[model samples]
Target: MQLVTWNTQWCCGLDGVVSPQRIVQHARALADFDVLCLQEIAVHYPALEGNAGHDQVALLRALLPGYQVFFGAAVDEWTPDGQRQRFGNLIATRLPVLQLQHHPLPYPADAGVRSMPRMCTVATVRDPGLGAVRVMTTHLEFYSKRQRMAQARALRVLHAQACAHAVAPPEASGDGSPFQSKAHTPHAVLCGDFNFEPHEPEHAAICAPAGADDSEGAPLGMRLWDSWRLLHAAAPQPPTFRLYDRRYGPEPGSCDFVFVSDSLKGRVQRFVVDAATQASDHQPVAVSIA
Candidate 1:
């Protein structure tokens, strides 16, 4: 299966043009992806540069027919005119979805730092090669380190919780009820614009080993491994953000990453970053599993 993750600056390119069609065209040019994960999707937010308050989710859905598009709005609020504005992440996949969850991440207060509510969208889909696998896409707090750390730790806890459930599933309900059986899998692929460099503590926290915090004592073994490292070995991950556009920073480095759980590490076949694209401020990262 081929999956690609990108932070489409609301589908606005470096030329100050907002076009969802361009974003879709660039993604397809990179690879024939079965799943596409996007961050910073805007809806009803015309204030964004070059954005016309277009419903990005609707546009993406219309553009990619036959693909299931799921959106999780982290910053959902109302304008003075009562128009609802949503900004967050989206996932488009052709795989058969078994279950889906929109998890609102921690948004602790940080004085004098600009930040927005964040969330992670989790979808358990049936892959042709990997059986049931969770594809989680998210965008974390950018300007605040405290909130980002908290959010990172929270992600580890959530992964642990899901792994525990996969080990010991809930009671099966024969009746057609809410407590019926659901697709559960420890195998997961967590990808998105993490907004933290590889050397940062937030990155290490997610890759850290599960310890006492896991009350269920689920033997998940080690935590997530960067898919790039799994295949690239000693090579550093190519820059994903600020390569084409240097307004964010002078030095180019990667803030976006694709991390796979230990169970799926061996299945990671290819990991590549499209560094040549200027479709957005960030480059698209693709990973293939077989």
Candidate 2:
């Protein structure tokens, strides 16, 4: 399966134009993705640069027909016009979605640092070859180091929780209720704009194992492995941000990445960063697993 993750910056390109259609076009040009994960999608928030309070989730849904779209709003509020405005991550997939979940990451208050609530959207999809696979996408806190670390820890906890569920699934009623059994695989792909460079401790924290106790004889749950490292062990990671847009600072480096559980490490066929697209301030990262 082919999956792509990108932070659209609300679809505003380097030219300062916010167009959802343009974002879709750029993504399609990258690859024929089975799943597309996006972060920083805004809805009814005109304060963003080049954004006019457009419903990005709706626009993307309309653009990609037959794709199941799931939006996890970390910042949800009502607009002056009484419309519900949301800002967060979105996952759209052409594969069959069996289950969906929105997990709000830890957001501890930090004084004098601009930060916002963040979330990860998890979807269990039926891949034609992989069968059941859990895919999750998230955008970590950018300004506050403490908050980002907490959020990273929370992601590890969530992964462990999902594994526990998979190992001991709940009993299902056979009374023909709508609550039927569904596929829940321990194998997961966590991808998104991590907001931390490879040199940062937060990156290592996320990839760290839950604990020795948690993996006592389980062949299912395992620590996440960096997809880039799995494929390019000797090469430096390609820059995924600050390549051309240096408004924040100079020096190009990667903050976006695709990480897979150890179980799926060998299945990782390709990992790439689309450095050519200026569709957003951040570049798109694609991963192919077979």
Candidate 3:
């Protein structure tokens, strides 16, 4: 299975153009991805640089004909004109989707830092190679360290709960109601802009061992393994943020990541980053699992 993740900066490229067409074209050029996970998708936010209040989800759906697009809006608010505005993450895939869940992450009160609500979009899809696996994409709070840490820990808890569910699935039910049984698997691919560096505590919080001190007698949970580290053991991780655009910081840092569960770590065949693309401030990352 081929998966690609990117922070599209609301489809605003470095050239001061907000074009979903270019984002789709460039992503297609990067790889023949079965699933594409994206962050910072905007809807009705004309105030953003170069954005004209376009519904990016609709635009992306029109562009990707065979794929299903799922969006989770972290910031959903009303404008004075009564139109709704949304900004958050999105996932598009050609694979068969079994179930979907949108989780609102913890947004703690940070007195002096500017922050926004955050969320994670989870899609359980049937991959031809990996079968039923969850693909989760999220963008954490960037400006607040306390909020970021809380969000990261919340993500780990969510993963562990899903893993526990997979280990002990509910009883089979085909009543054609909401309780109907769906495809369940522990295998997962979590990717997005974490807004924290590799050495940061938030990163450690995410990749930390699961179920180390479980109060409940649930099965031992599986910890996530960084895909880049699995493939590139010694070399430093390539910068995925602020490589060409130095407005954020003078030094480029690797903030975006794609992590897989321990079960899928051995299946990680390839990991690649498109460092040459100026489609967005952040670079696009792709991974292949066999």
Candidate 4:
């Protein structure tokens, strides 16, 4: 399974911020991903942006056929110029999307920024080639620790749901929910800008540290594992963010990543955070898992 995660900056790069064609061109060149998760996709609904009021999500779906696309709007607002726009993350999958769900994180009062809601989107896929997998995309609050903690709890709750749903009976359950009974914990691939490092508490709640050596030199920790660290191993320069913007991290940078569950870590044969890419402010992370 090939998966990708990128913050398109609403496809605002190179020439202009609202160039839809640039978004298509650059993202297509990024990778041929089976499952793609994008953040900051500027989709202006009710009133369109650019020429024909082209919906960014529609354009991407048109570009990549056969694959399924799902959008979760985090913030909806009206522009001063009198157009209403929605900015949020996107989840597109080639595998059969059996179920789709979204959750909005709660923001605190002291945070001061209650303008937009942080959202998480998940897609449970039934693939003919690779069995079944769940892919999720989300953007956490960048400024508030309180909001982020709340966001983390929201994600954990959603993660637990995905795990439980993966094994649900294919036939409708007693409550009318449909899921397969024999399914397992569901191979999940979480992609996005977590805004926290591997050792950070936020990271711990998401993809728990895995594949690292313990005191007994054994590979053990929690449930989820960092796919980036697993793929790169001990490469000296693994900076993803500093590849374009030089002033983001302290000693160079590397913030973007693709994290997977421990059960699927070995399935990942390739993982690359595109540092040299000029399409967006942050580099894109691509991972191939079997």
Clash totals for all models, in order? 0, 0, 0, 7
Sort by lDDT, top down from the best: 3, 1, 2, 4
lDDT of 1 by residue, 198-258 (tens): 8999999988876546563557484788898889886889999889788988999999999
TM-scores, one per candidate: 0.97, 0.94, 0.97, 0.78
TM-score of candidate 2 on Cα atoms, chains taken together: 0.94
lDDT value, residue 47 of candidate 3: 92
Which number leads on lDDT? 3
What digit string (tens of lDDT, one per residue) describes model 3 on residues 1-290? Answer: 89999999999999999998999998999999999999999999999999659899999999999999999999999999899999999999999999999999998899989999999999999998788989999999889999999999888888887888888889999999998997778898999999998888898898888886483223665788889989988688999998999998999999889999978999999999999999999999999987
Q: Which stretches of candidate 3 lie over 4 Å from their true place?
A: 213-218
How many clashing residue pairs, candidate 4? 7
lDDT of 2 by residue, 172-233 (tens): 65676667776757789999999899888998887887554454333344678889999998
**Across residues 183-247, which tens digit of lDDT does each residue of candidate 4 receive?**
44447777787666555688666654332323222134424667767776656426655465555
Which parts of model 2 have CA positions greater than 4 angstroms off? 175-180, 212-221
Model 1 steric clash total = 0
Q: Candidate 2, clashing residue pairs?
A: none
* C-alpha-based local distance difference test score of model 3: 0.91
* Clashing residue pairs, backbone N/CA/C < 3 A, model 3: none
lDDT for residue 239 in candidate 2, whole number 0-100:
93
Of candidate 2, the 10-residue stretch with the lowest lDDT total is 212-221
| Pairs of colliding residues, candidate 4 | 168-179, 168-180, 169-179, 169-180, 169-181, 170-179, 170-180
Q: Which of the two candidates, 2 or 3, achieves a greater TM-score against the reference?
A: 3
